[model samples]
Target: MEAYRLLIADVYELAGLSRRTSEEMARAVGQTAARWHVLSVLSDAPRTVPSAARRLGLAPQSVQRVIGDLVDSGHVEAVDNPDHARSPLMRLTGQGRRALDELFARSEDDRAAVVDRAGVTAGELAAAREVLRKLAGALRTSVPHP
Candidate 1:
């Protein structure tokens, strides 16, 4: 239990540090971390605003705002959704792809440095990811008490 508690703390700190680093990187590319994240999520495939928000663990309204901004900046576009008329799917534009590609190029070094600094084996990383996923699933399914 103590080890688990420590792991949670470490994860929290890591997330904060990562967010800051991402913010810096995004700023270098003339974007914010929130925009970068929304772009990354859209890069995989077009999704409705709500769906993208769920994937990003962000509020739907917040995601909607980012999507609106992206559209205004010509980074993303809203396409017709066959399944839902009211909710359109947001897809990446060429400019968005270029920006995302540039961001990836910029972060390559930081990603490598994390591996070098941690000195953790690939297997260890995989195991850690699996454990975190399992815990996340459990937490997501937990019953809420009023």
Candidate 2:
């Protein structure tokens, strides 16, 4: 049988590295992962805070905090939602777009480094991704929906 401990350790390390990288890049662009994610989501179209929270699987309060920070930083603007007068819609500002562009460039370079270090071919990575997707789907299917 495969060593579950080893798999868990690898997953933990990857998660840590991902978070660290996101934090470093986000700070360099004067934002956090939550803020970045919100801006990215609203880049194409405006969205309500609750919608953004659901997409990110975050608490509404947490998303609200990030949204407030983004608004204070002038990276996003909140406007009245036409569909729902009570709910406000958030949209990205030009500054947010510029920041996202810079972060994406850095992320691309970081991903390239990881791929080179892993020495895994594109085909191998694609196969692994497919397997992981199937596994995730199976797990989700096994769980009863609320």
Candidate 3:
């Protein structure tokens, strides 16, 4: 399991960079990554909490908590879902869109720096992404949908 530990550690370190970057931006903008994700997901169109949760691969409660924060912060709004009266649809505000744009821009710069420092080529990154996608697909198929 030593090899798995090392691989997990490497992934954790890389993920840490993202978390740190997000924390810095969140402090500046006064919004957390969870909140940002909810807003970004709804930036394209309003979505029910369950749909957002599934899209994020997060538990519904976790997504709801973030959505509650966004709503409280005026970054998102909840409107009645015509299809489901019990569930409300979430939509991003203008401020949310601006925040997402800034975060994405900064993330792009950070990613480029990492790629340059690691001497990783675009093709290599693409291949890694493809492999991950296949792995995720296989896992999804293996899991039973409720």
lDDT of each: 0.92, 0.79, 0.80
Point out where model 3 deviates above 4 Å: 1-13, 80-83
Clashing pairs in 2: none
Best by TM-score: 1
The Cα error of candidate 1 at residue 36, in Å, is 0.6
User: Per-residue lDDT for 93 in model 2?
Assistant: 86
lDDT of 1 by residue, 71-97 (tens): 999999999999999999999999999
Writing each residue's lDDT as its tens digit, candidate 3 over 1-146 gives 79757765886797777778777776676667777677778878999988898777789999998888888877788888889999988888887788788777766777798799999999999997787677668878998654
| TM agreement with the true structure for every prediction | 0.87, 0.71, 0.76
The most accurate candidate by lDDT is 1
Per-residue lDDT for 88-116 in model 2, tens only?
99988898788878877878888888889
lDDT of 1 at 85: 100
Q: Which TM-score value belongs to model 3?
A: 0.76
Candidate 2 or 3, higher TM-score?
A: 3
**In the order shown, what is each candidate's alpha-carbon RMSD?**
2.5, 3.8, 3.0
